[model samples]
Target: MFFTRKKDIVGIDIGSSSIKLIQLKSQKGTYQLQNVGLVPLPAEAIVDNTLMDSASVVEGVKTLIDSLKITAKEAACSISGNSVIIRKISLPVMPTEELEEQIHWEAEQYIPFDINDVNIDFQIIAPDDIDSSKMNVLLVASKKDIINDYLAVFTEAGLKLTVVDVDSFAVQNAFELNYNPDPDEVIALVNIGASVMNMNIVKDGISLFTRDVQLGGSLYNEEIQKHFGVNNEEAERIKISESAADSDRLKDILARANDTLAIEMRRSLDFYNSTAGEGKIGKVYLSGGGAKSAMLPETVSQKLGIPAEILNPFSKVRFDEKEFDPDYLKEIGPLVTVAMGLATRRLGDK
Candidate 1:
């Protein structure tokens, strides 16, 4: 929303647990993966979407770029959590040139923070009803401090950050690129990161309801650590069944965590239903690292009474079989969905 993007830009996801980068080349409208990499960060670097250790993030980005040999200096990154806000609002029909000034004034009522503290962007979603008085707009705002922090890190890491987008929209972009949802179908895109889960409900390819739930994979690791008396790294290994423990007790712990995850997702779905008055979600697409949990899809499906599937962000993307293994891509599909979406962003797309 701030800068004009170049023709070639890398998509980078700076998350609580790691930094991910994906660069793609487009030819005749089809995206071909050029480079992809992930670098794990110390848990102290970020917590609950807050940057706790700036140096670690800076080094992580540098390392990811170096390891992947990504030459693209201009990149797109995303932000989420409580510091960011998204709302679909209606305003009296007005000229395009006037909407920007009007939005800053009208946004005061909807935004909780001081108006000057945030950087805002809006998109006209419903331009129909020229005869009517109002038009629908999707408003997005991010705390200026947070945005500055991101810009600083990317700069420090030797890259130019061109686009700063919200996490849910990036996931939505990825979903549309990979799959075409039915026009009448309501679908939920749930992206579970280390510390937050982004839930965006969409219909006809437009976001109708979005929420960031503060429950994610890190909580599962914490539970495993507390229950098994292990540190975080070991707990992650045990959580994924890499390091052995009492199998029965491990199942019990994971079962409880899965239940909690489904419950949090259910609460969001219920809220979306009540406020939006939308019909039930016909299907759900789960992405991000937390989607790797074995029982997650079943748990979410059973709780939400909706069919759930792991989203394949590469369904339509092309890549060399040797450079990217099919089995590996299948396994990491959920993990890279957001970055894949960000990678598809163009020079001046809405």
Candidate 2:
């Protein structure tokens, strides 16, 4: 069944609050959107990117796929949260097999979990210049239990999983597809998810550092709902649509939430700088649902003293007349960055 056939692959992002799916195809260097659907998760189904109720997620995924009429069986998915760890390390040059064996010991020094409890994966970045006998490799690990739970949900939805990429890498891939930053300069890719904010610093197209913060869009919604004594739906609407309007009360609430986001981002960037001593962040690229907020970019730019801009993955992709919706895409485009990156996965690579 896994032959040379190029099957359409769907990118499914099951976030803390909602499940979003998108299918796309490349046409003459342009990506044309094929299908898109969104479904809200049940209350407390998923918390902090971990699925507590597989039935809720399975039903959500199944319903979204059916509603969108997506025929693709192979899907590209992602995993995030504190359980996943990625690091670039230097190792003495050796055969791939021996290198793999040695990396496990090295991982033990960094990873906090038991060796058997994690799924270990690695990629050799390049040979070290200072030491010809050494190689720089990237190591990635995720809790096996977490991945199994994620896979079980998809299996229940009748989807054939093709790639189980980490969320930070997906955000990086999405950023790469949209922008080609200067190789020598460092660019920050900050993904503001519902409950977690993942910040990745890339230089020369290589991920130099990555950090996840415990703050995101949900903070703003919760703050507004509490301050205004409104329902969740009303709070979200005010956060996105009314925050920019000429309403004094809404503006005050938005300012407080933006302040919180700024402080969280600052903490992450500070950690990134401390860990990545030599590499400095040149610019910040904002992605995820929270990046769609009108005043967010300016607020972050001011707070971090770095140029910040919302990512538009479709900027380079050509739109098919029947497939593209300009108005909707403009609003929901930032949320598609991760899904777009997952959709662009090409089997095997370095």
Candidate 3:
């Protein structure tokens, strides 16, 4: 007997502090959430976007997949941090075939790593309306070692890897699907994880600029631990709760940390504006663990002078209300943006 299988691909977002899995089914053109799961990893399981303990990561991924009952055998995963590089460079207008042949040569000028050590890919973005001689191209180069690490982890978990994407692009995919921003709206999608923050600038549903900062939610936890004299777990709980012993003192520490993060965010935005010359970012969308902080949105908005809000990746996707808690989902909504984006992919998506 022969059986036909579904084409859905599970989206697995392996972060420094947690692993998030999301599976979605597409009927006609609309998507519905099929399954979702989150599993926390031991401290330092992943640091600075490097999978230090593949066995532990495999175990975490396996447990989450089993718990979610996700049957999809193909998975789409993403990576970020210092090992991956994304650049938009102007190239002389040429045919797709010609561009493909010359991309490796062109990439060598922009990518910092040894040409042989990275996997290079390019996409031809729409050219400047006025510049006919030069067309814009999005160049992506990722370290082969990092790619192999992800492949090994997913393989050990017994899943076929369908596509490997960048974290910023995945988040952009999810945002475009749910938000459907206006063609001219310049928006920044910032996903703050445990040890890194991915800032992607999108205008008219296309990524124009992206940068990874080494600052993330771990800073707050560490600061809280130092200030309150508590262990990591207790520090995490106290960091998000309002009933700490010295509430006023705790607030001061959090404010300082938040301000420091905001300053870094501002630097990124400033760099984007100065370099892209497209336009100022009209708004900012926050995702990942750090977005849950009590004062982040307010602090970022006040400091950056840009309106900031948490992005709900499920706004346009359907799900049975009875199967998931709406309030709880909203609370953790930002954390799943990248996974939801990855889940939107198919086996051959480019």
Candidate 4:
């Protein structure tokens, strides 16, 4: 049983284009969406997932809370992009004390950064039944500066940071919570953000392949800006606009975006397939703002032989309709997978 742990907290996803917040109250295996809101980022609040201008992020977060009427003090957030690294390694099956000692020596082969500059943590997966002598471990590392910057935003907004997670794990958390796919199945979770696309492949609930691509929704806007000679703001408006006047413009932008994303998707899958050994990816789950593009799933399906579909983090979870707009929630559901996963983090789980 995956995602057995439950908790009451807010899931805050800070992306390059916007900040999305969600708070859910669990009751009898169902989730109640107590609050949901989004705050648009300033022109330079985040660049490539790094907090470039703290003041802008803080201001936007503060305004989002006020406008959304969110009273929850504790929230969960996640980080992605260049500063994060994930690796899978094997270690002898041993007691916790011995395992810690072995991890340091093991780090020499995995971590590229110096031990002093990075914060390291690991979660033990199931013991290797075939080998019986080894255990699977998932290692995660993020630069201290990146984590401190995120904490600073919460501090300025007067929100408590109850948990911090990387985007790949967060997406995995959301998947476990909602889908609960078979642990033995190799699954791919792809998060397409404004400026970065992240793909994480997991087998038996442990991460095996991880990578980040430098193409995302922003490229669509840039293409629109160049093709139509429109300002950034105007290009963004047309990208998601429902106005009849912009229908043709939307189709054109998405066509080009799909083509570009398909190229990157092929490269990622090829890299994973070449190194995955016996672990073959069975399906692709798409999330993030760019994933909402109607053509993205189909495009990816054509480029990669695996079945592709949009991932809704709340599909299986029930939420109170009185406190939330079901339609609105569904509209933005794909983008909240990371935030929802982070918020579902229970105390003492790590």
**Per-prediction TM-score:** 0.96, 0.92, 0.96, 0.91
lDDT by residue for model 1 (104-181), tens: 998889899999999988888875455467888888988899889999999999998888888899999999988988
lDDT of 3 by residue, 305-336 (tens): 98999999889889899998788779778888
lDDT of 1 at 197: 97
TM-score: model 1 vs. ground truth? 0.96
As for lDDT, the candidate ahead, 3 or 4, is 3
Residue ranges of candidate 1 with Cα displaced over 4 Å:
127-131
TM-score of 2: 0.92
Backbone atom clashes (below 3 Å) for every candidate: 0, 0, 0, 0
Pairs in clash, predicted candidate 3: none
Candidate 2 lDDT trough over 10 residues, lowest sum: 1-10
Error of model 1, residue 192, in angstroms: 0.6
Whole-model lDDT values for every prediction: 0.87, 0.80, 0.87, 0.79
In the predicted model 4, the residue pairs found to clash are none
Return the top candidate by TM-score: 1
Candidate 2 residues lying further than 4 Å off, grouped into runs, are 1-8, 95-97, 243-246, 274-278
Instruction: Give lDDT tens digits, candidate 2, residues 1-350.
Output: 00024556888888887888878886777577788777888757887667888898999999988988888788888877787888888888888888767777888887889988988878787788689989888889888888888778888899977678877888887778778887888888889888888888888778877888878888878877787788888878887777534478777777777778877888878887887655778788899887876588899999999899988877776666566688787778778778888887754433
